[model samples]
Target: MLLAGCAGAPPAPAERPAAEPAPPPVAAVPGVGVEERDWLPPLFSGVEDEAHYYISRLPDRRFVTTYGGEEHPRPWYIAAERLGQIGEPAIPLLAARLESSDEYELMLALYALMLASQDPSLMAATGGDTLELGSVLDPRHNAENLALARAWWQRQGWRWE
Candidate 1:
């Protein structure tokens, strides 16, 4: 006769807990379909609205300070300054402006993009080899600038956060 401990067959294997489901895939564009406007406080309705206001006012001429100490129109400087300060959050909105037929808007958007991202390559893409604001804003280079800016946006815009 078999011993009491050895008589019974080996016990069945213990059951394992069910495996967890895989997480949902993330969107290629981080904020693709969400209503970003609703998330902000009432003072500023949305980033787009704020960006539009500043972009609409981008100056045709650069602000200059006189030797006598008189400052040029501060509003002009302020608009570009604000856009620059908005940084990456302002990128997609600025990129949308790239398709406009208006050279002013296109240039302003690209300029703001350069300022926002602080990416010298964006300015370089506009054919401005230097970081000087004047070189990037020069209207003489508009066609080449727009073409290159558009190409850059095509390759890199969606990748921005």
Candidate 2:
């Protein structure tokens, strides 16, 4: 007896959807630096909008000031404050900042993570105090501390502590 179950026709291949067009680039003002244009809010915006402008610029590592307050803390401090204010959304960015080569950036990122998480214990686990972290130029210590902090965050699975 001949088996009639074998199919003669192969199934047609699935068609892929067409790629969508890319969105237009954000318009930057002429003569303004790219970082400035991106982070500096258009003049006359509210304070919160202005705060966001500075917050958005944190990754640049160049912008160091935002309007307001007599203290005028360093740019890194401003970035940390903003990141802390941003909370969980800032974690991955702060985590990525953990890899920064600049000492200030690395410290700021770690501090930001701590502040954003509202956990002082994280600093202790990082193997140094804020002073040591900010002052130590020893790459070895820095790398080790960074590794410890990064490992902690990794172990925590990057969730807020």
- Top TM-score hit: 1
By TM-score, how accurate is candidate 1? Answer: 0.48
- The root-mean-square deviation over C-alpha atoms between each candidate and the true structure, in angstroms, is 14.7, 18.0
Which 10 residues in a row give candidate 1 its minimum summed lDDT? 31-40
- 29-118: candidate 1 lDDT, tens digit per residue: 222222222222245477667766666666444421223224643223445556776765666777677777766656666677667766
Provide the global lDDT of candidate 1 against the true structure. 0.58
Tell me each candidate's TM-score. Answer: 0.48, 0.43
lDDT of each: 0.58, 0.56
Using lDDT, give the best candidate's number: 1
Note the residue pairs that clash in candidate 1: none
